[model samples]
Target: MKTPEAGDAIAAAPRRGPLHGLVVLDITRVVAGPYCSMILADLGARVIKIEHPDDPDYVRGFPPFVGEGDDRFSAFFAQYNRHKEGITLNLKHEAGRELLKQLVARADVLVENFRPGTMERFGVGYDTLRAVNPKLVYAAISGFGQTGPNALRPGFDNSGQATGGLWSMNGYPDRTPVRVGTIIGDVSATLFAAIGVLAAVREAERTGQGQMVDVSQQDAVLALTENAVVKYTVDGEIAGPLGNDHPFVRPYGQFPCRDGHVFFGGYNDKLWALSCRKFGTPDLVSDPEIDTMAKRFDPEVYARRVKPVVENWFRERSKAELEAMAGDDIPLCAVKNIREVVEDPHIAAREMIVDVDYPQGRIGMFGTPIKLSRTQAQASGRAPNVGQHNAEVYADLLGIDAESLQRLKSSGVV
Candidate 1:
């Protein structure tokens, strides 16, 4: 596929997503905010990403570059910012702030991830933008939230994980709890912010009034701790990491194979019996000591009677061999690394990985997980260079011709 020129992509290639006609003004940088607007862009919203004229998105300077020197681009930024139009504006400048207000007046949604009062400091906060366009769905994503006591504090992905209590329940119980392998806090908050934006947009369409949608990274991560809070409250028991072992299920954890590891879930009676039969120990199914599910769940019994046999059986077989043996009867899966995942036939069949073309070459990125019957939800364009669409956007939206745009650029307002 040929790569479209930076400014021309959005104009030339029309989106066929469910939000085809929705216009989004994205004043967000980095993961949480960019990820949210990226979702909207993938779903067919016309997203216009505005960055600071002097200081662009920090990720644009990050490593893992493609091309050389002046032409080099950050693959990290590209993956999350694809399918959106790009422009630059100096929010600190009066004319620039006014320009943003004008854009907001015409936009259906505006998303920002700055600290709670950052936008308000610049005179373009939700209240200001809402006043400009009452129907605008304003989404504010932050570490704490817009109204909390900690809203003024600076926060990052790790801050969310730590503050939300997710970090306390991860990793082995004997060691210090570790943060999740990926940026779950930011990503979860992104998903929630997108949902909020969509819901607010729907309500706006119904009543011709838009409201603020505030999402906190810490709040989102706390919501994802899933029963940990209830476990502590109801049973008066604090949950800690069990080193991949389920607290209740006996044989529902990862075990080593000849080459690597595989997760086995023969915790139930029927599956346990099937697993025991497959291990060439059908007699163990009726064994008095470890026969029933309840008995198997006992840690001492599992360690003494079941773990040894299960480990011995697994150690003798490679991952592929164990998978073949388990087939569909026993719930088992070989733990795969990134390389295997990229090469797996199942992932390919589902179109979970895709490539976006750049001026220099193509960079591979994860495809959209959303599937719709009537509309497409995929990354169909490349990330734009800073201010790549300034002329196009300014001309089309604000009626700024080439000379006026050059003046604005020279004045450092754009």
Candidate 2:
């Protein structure tokens, strides 16, 4: 498949997504904001990224460049900001602010991730923008939200995980709290922002009035705590980590095998019996002290009677052997490393890993997970160079001529 450079004429391509013809002013940077914008872009929104001419997105400086010298580009930036157009605008300048207001006037949505008061100080808050375009859906993603005492404090993905109780419930009980391997906080916040913006956009279409959609990273992460919040409130139990095991379910965690690891879990009696029978330990199923779910909760009985039987069976078998023996109804899976995941046939068949060609080489990144029946998500394009669509957006959308654009560039207003 051919991947076009974002510098190519984006307007010439036919839009194939549900968000076709919608315009988005993408003023956010880094993880949460860019992630939301990327989803919009994939859905066929014409996202125009705003950046300072002198200092573009900080991720542009991150390592793992695809080329050398003038052609060098950050792969990190490409991972999140793909499928969006770019334009420079130093908001500190009056001309820049005026240009942004002009864009806002024509935009269907405006997304930002600045601290609570940042947009208000810049004179482009929801009220100011709504005054210009009443039907514009304004989405704001912040660390703690637009209100609350901690709204003014600077925050990042780490802060979201720490404050939301994710870190506390991640690791083993005896060890210190450990952050998750991936940035779940930022990713969850991004998804929540996208959902909020989409909901607001749908409502605006019906009511003819757009509203503000505020998403908090901390709140988003906290919503993913499963039963932790309820466990404390309802049962007076502060949930703690239990390693990879299910908190209340016995025999529901990773067990060591001969060559690799396998995770098989089922809380019900049927699954428990099947697991015991599959492991060639049918005798253990009828053992009085370890038969029922209630009896399996005792660590002493589990270690002495149950653990040894399960371990002995798994220790003699390989992951592949165990998988072959267990049927589909049995919840069994081999723990795959990154390389194995990249090579998995299921992932390839699902198109999870996709490639985008650069001037230097082809780079692989995870594709959009959302699949629509009629409208498909696309990632087969290069990330834009800094301000790559300046002339096209300014001259075409804003009706500024080449001479005026050059002047704007020279005066550091673009």
Candidate 3:
């Protein structure tokens, strides 16, 4: 089987967006790190995805593949890797390490997700690379960060959620704590890492000095618990799952409809009054037991007075009917399933669901959420095959000619 050339199946589109001209060396694999780099790529950064020649990224073999034979590739991998260039370099090899250093000298940022000391062992850690290019912003995404007792411990999304106290607070109070629907730990860390990288890059540009941005999955997930930590510390109250209910707000939860469920938020007094009128229960507004926000916030009062009336109103209507009634008056929305979300008029209008063309076929993925008026963030092009840009990137970045690149490939260096 003949291998595809650089940009053979997926041609490189002209760079646009806010991050145009930024050079990113993405030496990460799998979800977290690749996702962060993908965000940068979507924002118009020139991201070069580097991988080991022999091993490649594990996600390349993941399921839900597209195409067949040599043209086959993982849809899951493409979801996070699109709009970036790909190259393979055996970083374990001394020559490959030297070549990476040369590339680093020209890069503005480098992102990696290996364990704490992996880069140091390879002699290309932040401290080493920062010296190679003093203005380079090195961002490291790890399970437990680069410091503390758990630094060396292997961490994953589940472990991060478990140790960070997010897992214990999810699900129903009577049931076993469930992990969040998605890999929130990894994803939150990715967002934080990207922010840190951009912030550090800005600083580097101004001060002509670079620094390391350390982002930990556990730390990021813990930070996103939304007052769970403070509620325990300040009020001496350990919060547990309340199903779909808000902790402090009455009538702020999912209510049953004829067809399905709808989330209704009438927590404030004004909204409560508005909701009461909208639900054809205006008399409930002046009821002494649950008249004001404070009274409705009382668990006993809400359970006895508020829940029954609001739930009854919702149960009498279908999701569509309830939505139509709510309109712009009440803060409510029908709970949408995945199919509904994909087909939703709002989602379509916002361009949240986008289709990217590939050699195999056109696959739909989520578009960028960040919308800049001038330099719009967008996802373009398809992901590259392993080492697809070896010759191009090597020759372009390091001045390595065709002869030298072939020699390096022959020596198992790139």
Global lDDT for candidate 1? 0.88
The digit string of per-residue lDDT tens for model 2 on 290-348 reads 77887776677766776666677678788888888876878887899988887889898
| TM-score to native of every candidate shown | 0.94, 0.93, 0.95
Predictions in order: lDDT: 0.88, 0.83, 0.87
lDDT of 1 by residue, 109-212 (tens): 99999998888999988888878788889999999999867988888999999999999989998999989999999999999999999999999999999999
The candidate maximizing TM-score is 3
Candidate 3 segments whose C-alpha is farther than 4 A from its true place? 1-13
Among the numbered candidates, top lDDT falls to: 1
Pairs in clash, predicted candidate 1: none
**Candidate 1 segments whose C-alpha is farther than 4 A from its true place:** 1-13
Question: Over the stretch 1-414, how does candidate 3's per-residue lDDT look in tens digits?
Answer: 122221222223377878887889999988989999999999988899999999999999887887898788788899899888899998899988888888888788999999999999998888888777888889999999999999998889888899888998899988999898999998999999999999998998899988999999999999988989999999999978778888888879998989999999988999999988988899988988888999999999889888999899898799999999989888899999999999999999988888887788778888878888888888756888999988777766666788878888899998
Clashing pairs in 3: none
